[model samples]
Target: MVDTPAPGTVRPGGRTARVRETVLRTAGDLLAQGGFEALDLAEIARRAGVGKTTVYRRWGTPGTLAADLLDDMATQSVPRADTGSIEEDLRANAHLVVKTLTEPRQGRLFKALIAASLCDEQAAEALHRFYATRIEEWAGCVTDAVQRGELPDGTDAQRVIAAVSAPLYYTLLNTGDPLTEADADRAAKAALAAARAGTWSTAAPRGRPTPNCDN
Candidate 1:
């Protein structure tokens, strides 16, 4: 009963797309303003000017609505950078995270979504998928670096990319520290250093051909 269309099934500029956009927009606004506890399907339908029955039929629960929102967010997320330098690419990734986390509306929206994931299994799975998508997208930076001989051949691209964001999330969720551009730069630099030191390199026991870092 998810509102999101199946892959390759959504038509551009159609009524279904319009309905989804309106409903998701209203849902995001509600989450940002009042958090997950305040997201009501009936209110979303009313605010979006869509039929309650349509909302109820397509997205049966708050968790499904939140999961759908996360799906949309992942689909619309920014593409990774290709600056020909691993440092620059990682910095770009880190800065983008900081920008999203520092923006008032987006910051609150993400917090609300994280809260929803903490309490709802459906939302949690969607949240995990969202991060996985983002990480996989950015992992290209590391793989490209490896191809260009900028990183060790066995470096784990996804792990390196995750390293760039882990500290930022820790600050956001635990440290109560204000995230700044400096923090982003430092994070990227630390990840780059660790990557260069082969911290994420996969070890091949004894004599097996080393697996491709891009794998």
Candidate 2:
């Protein structure tokens, strides 16, 4: 006779993980299908075969849901590309960021989040944190290049990260132009040129001794 184990105790945590994944995937699908307005928590619960109480209990409000969704999106983000040079890394980062901003439903979602952040302080903080994480992640690539002598010593990593995105966002929001590969390349080249010119290196601490700092 074959032995059969009891149910419910073997994979309880796994079941909960699957449920959460289902909810997140459903929310992503709704966002992809229609913009922010289409993301009804009740509808999402129904679609995901979960309970409305569960959704509301977990996320609370629409703004909270949006903020959490962006957090998840950031978690799913691709790591910075390493191509042995700041130029290549910045170019790749710019292109990927542009791609995210120009995507169909994601574009609308960003606009919605930006508007919400303008009105709500918590939302603004969440958005700020999301961008900060991405910036820091990309900045690590530039810092690595600087350490390798590909760039001047003491280059500001955060500024290099910001330089890659600033013009792209400006063109995207103000100029109303689609960001192309050429535009990404231009931004990368300009930032790399400025960084190599020692614009960012000048801000380094003058005559500071290394206090046993290790990589």
- Please report, as a residue range, the 10-residue window in candidate 1 with the lowest summed lDDT: 4-13
Runs in model 1 deviating more than 4 A are 1-13, 204-215
User: How far is 80's C-alpha from truth in model 1 (Å)?
Assistant: 0.4
TM-score of candidate 2 against the unseen true structure: 0.79
lDDT of 2 by residue, 39-94 (tens): 78899999999999977776666666666666766777889999987778988998
lDDT at residue 136 of model 2 (Cα atoms):
86
What is the C-alpha local distance difference test score of candidate 1? 0.92
TM-score of each candidate structure, all chains considered together: 0.89, 0.79
lDDT of each: 0.92, 0.78
Give the root-mean-square deviation of each candidate in angstroms. 5.4, 8.3
Worst lDDT run of 10 residues, candidate 2, spans 4-13
